[model samples]
Target chain A: MPSQAFAPPAFADVLAAAARIAPHAHATPVLRMRSLDALAGCALHFKAEHLQRGGAFKFRGACNAVWSLDPEQAAPGVVTHSSGNHGAALALAAATRGIACHVVVPENAVAAKLAAITAYGATLHRCEANLAAREAACAAVGQRTGATLVHPYADARVIAGQGTAALELLNAGIGLDALVVPVGGGGLGAGTAIAIAGVSPSTRLFLAEPAGAADTAASLARGARVTDIVPETVCDGLRATLGAPNFDILRAAGAEAITVDDAGTLAAMRLLWQRGKQLVEPSSATALAAVLQQRERFAGLRVGIVISGGNVDPHALYEAGALHGARA
Target chain B: MPSQAFAPPAFADVLAAAARIAPHAHATPVLRMRSLDALAGCALHFKAEHLQRGGAFKFRGACNAVWSLDPEQAAPGVVTHSSGNHGAALALAAATRGIACHVVVPENAVAAKLAAITAYGATLHRCEANLAAREAACAAVGQRTGATLVHPYADARVIAGQGTAALELLNAGIGLDALVVPVGGGGLGAGTAIAIAGVSPSTRLFLAEPAGAADTAASLARGARVTDIVPETVCDGLRATLGAPNFDILRAAGAEAITVDDAGTLAAMRLLWQRGKQLVEPSSATALAAVLQQRERFAGLRVGIVISGGNVDPHALYEAGALHGARA
Candidate 1:
């Protein structure tokens, strides 16, 4: 891995990215449900990143990275390894700049996301299921296409770009007590922690991870890297092993970590679908599960949760929970 | 039916409501999209009412109506007939004031919506599936419980309240060339027309209806009321025959009505789910369907489409369109 330094991003970085992509990116809204807030025993504010361009917070970083590429490098274009949102985001960002994009997507990736990447004018290189295969395929594509690799979470610029969402939320001038985020590759969590630390120091930063893929929690506990664990979470986006640079930034953030079971995540997803009426991916639901499972801890606090994405196969929701009891 | 005289509301009513509800309601954001613009052949600016309280635009009117009631009347609480969003909205509004609320919901209402009404400390009185049964049940409930009736759309307070959304959107200063709203009971569309006419006269207003239930369309063409059309649309929220007062307001404001087929609605719903990554209800999708269908008329114009609600049943989405493809 060609790693960038793991220093936390500053408020200036986020403000600059927001300015750079002001015309391209959406300033997504924050949603609130007062009755649901009473149930959670907290004032719950949802930052609706699921409605952002390319359907996830990944677009902010993707746009910044693709737009920042040198003219000659832009000619050859950008490359990334992602099974879903990041691939589509980079494709859209590159397409906006009239540049080529190569994506290494797994063979078992959701078909809708693959179609989206293609629709955004990106060439896809399908790979096997394993991490080694994904890395190998990515290397081959980057070498053959002479495309600059935009590591989803490990790059400094990408992390800086990801902080822009938190900036926009804070800039909305709503005073929130806590900021909750899904722990995926750790870019979002680390960026959010850094962003809130600068703009709103009082807001506590918490990371929600699927219990099946609690790599970030384990890594934080071990005080060193632990990359041997295999993830089996339904939250596909959070399956990545914590990146080295992201781990370093997260540690500096003093971020709190919460683990939610797949069942809990599904319950949270159902709550949002039925009550909040937003179709969100399982990854986004993880953050909600954290607040729901530990309601006492969050009681009376004003909390903000990032609704990370909504790129699920609606068929999968039927398959997993079609006739599930509403109150369950 | 008891009806009020046709009269346009003052712009001051909108400004007053905005100030009155500022601390209570969300200053809902105005979201812009170039991709949707390209698809609709118009510069599309979506006012995201789907993120509002009760997951629909009905909350603005319901809140305003409930709050504006005489203190003694509000204490006895409010009653309404709705199988969907308006019921939930009134329940929430009444609960916030710690008042008694009675809602007459149809027998075939969404199971989740019934739960929402009860969750908000409101009493639900279920009636038969027909419209006559709903109104009769609502009247009986009001008489028996000694509650004030909060009519869904025809009430003057509700119309003035619904206009608050358009007022907020224009306050964001998007300067759209036209505004399109999904027409059901016509509170939102009619209110929007009056607000736009007074505050931004250059912006034209439109009501988009489902072709399967095009009462508003026929009524506008015939220059009178159209009643008893067989409503076969999947957009359950748009099933109501227009209230005489709503027709009077929209007709006086000169707002035209457009209708799109069920297939067109499904296509629009799919585009919102897949491309926009949103989970809006079929009622909200009608306006988007209308805009997507007529590219020539709105080409290159800044068009505002109100995403009315996000209360869809996940199963409904799968049933309406699992394998379906959206037509560009």
Candidate 2:
């Protein structure tokens, strides 16, 4: 399918995605931490996607995409280019359908993530640490195996599937004033925007982005796609440039952006682990960081923060002394 | 209350305790980890006491003990000697009833645990690392402040309160062939024994103890309480000698012991964090370690493992290189 042919996922797609992925995906719990709420000066409802299958929200989209494929389309299997969580999620999703999975992983990917992708029985193709190289490697694998390519966050099905998390949250009747989600390729943010618009129109959407990889923020600021910067951040999951359709959807939904530095993200991650007892990765922490960084804006509001994933290397984080300080 | 006059907590007490604590304590979720089940070759139901208020199963007992107090008794507040979790739990529980709480903490307790105790508005009294010093300090505090002593595990109210966790697990309707819990002061284990006896008589009970602090196992083997050995394990929460009443209750229940070394506990802790997405402390990991260590005994059986706590210092664990390698 060509990029031009792709349509932006609507709230209806999210509803369908919820029903389609119900059998395979986990309806992760919404956790409330009083300590966290006290710190943020808001009632925070945390959608614990870190506890989802494959230890991330990536599973929802991966499972939806894999199962949505017809028998003939799925016969050749599925392929994707991912630095970590999506690769493992897609591999696990493909495994559920007993189909082959090919993942093009960048050279600089975390070792623990590579181990997980392999553990999930994906055929990994190593590529240079660049989008061009990753895409080329993925295309070559697709050509060879006739596998259908599942773009990490750009695809409509993936965006719709990612929205199910927000749908579930809204369905819980938490009456949130605003929702915050970390934006990488913007699947979760765009999907969440659509879900909030349909189910709770009064709810506002805030996209959390790492300052080092703040293309989404830049895009939102300039009212256009921004894909030129070289990403630099500890959040391995939030390094991708905002995808075109994702940008369009987010812009259309009037989503706001909250950018957090690496220091803020690390501190928030530590707080989540220590106080919340939830082992969310740095990418997941960005959502909390955003809420905390802008406390004045979120004060006394019922805010929802989506913990995007928990596929981190504790050893690596420890080695970096990321867990040493009490900043947040 | 004199030791000679005190009776072991019975099923009736457990029922009463549950009712008393229902308003204060969380009925923690029963989580299922399929990967963990596959690894252990059994259906594993994880009683997530780590997510309990004050980050441990200790809250149930602490809350019950505080609420069970008469208004005049509660007015003077409560006091306890604890290395970690119980202190924080008691402090938090006391805070709920707007009562003063004094915690006698050993010098060598984890810094994070100390922070949690202080965070919960408890007055901390530091003592030497010995059990005798801790008790002396606790008694002195009680004498000076007119506070009621809430023993970590020895008191009937506490034991009954601890039983509520297992009661909730049993109430979840997940029929299990066996249940596992880390044996520290044995409050949780003793309580669990009563719960199992009352709710599911056929369910076997297994106490997961640290080999370096295997007094519970020693007491069971010798058919008497043994409080002589110096504990030398990394599991901060499981270093206590078995309480006398706890021993008596376990002996009556014919509970089995499964001791795990520090290395096994560390490995299992890492696995729980990495795969189970639960950042459990070493004490909590012992239950999973026990299951993994004695796989054959639990194979094909529906097993319940109570994750005791999550008050670990990630910085300390990392500095000690506890999260370095994979051995499980």
- Strongest candidate by TM-score: 2
lDDT tens per residue, model 2, B62-122? 9999998889888988999985788889999999999999999878876766778888899
Give per-residue lDDT, candidate 2, residue B327: 21
Model 2 spans > 4 angstroms off: A1-4, A107-111, A326-328, B1-4, B106-112, B126-129, B326-328
RMSD of 2: 2.2
**TM-score, cand. 1 vs. native:** 0.90
Candidate 2's TM-score reads: 0.95
Those runs of model 1 whose alpha carbons end farther than 4 Å from true positions after fitting are A1-19, A107-110, A326-328, B1-23, B72-75, B105-112, B126-146, B316-328
Candidate 1 residue-wise lDDT, A96-193, digit = tens:
89988999988898776788899999999999987789889888877787888888887766777888888888767789888899997888887787
Evaluate residue B88 in candidate 1 and report its C-alpha lDDT on the 0 to 100 scale.
87
Error of 1 at A68 (Å): 3.7
Question: Worst ten-residue run, lDDT, model 2 chain B?
Answer: B1-10
TM-score of chain B of each: 0.94, 0.96
Docking class of 2: acceptable
DockQ of candidate 1 compared with the true complex: 0.36
True contacts reproduced, candidate 1: 0.31
**Highest lDDT model number:** 2
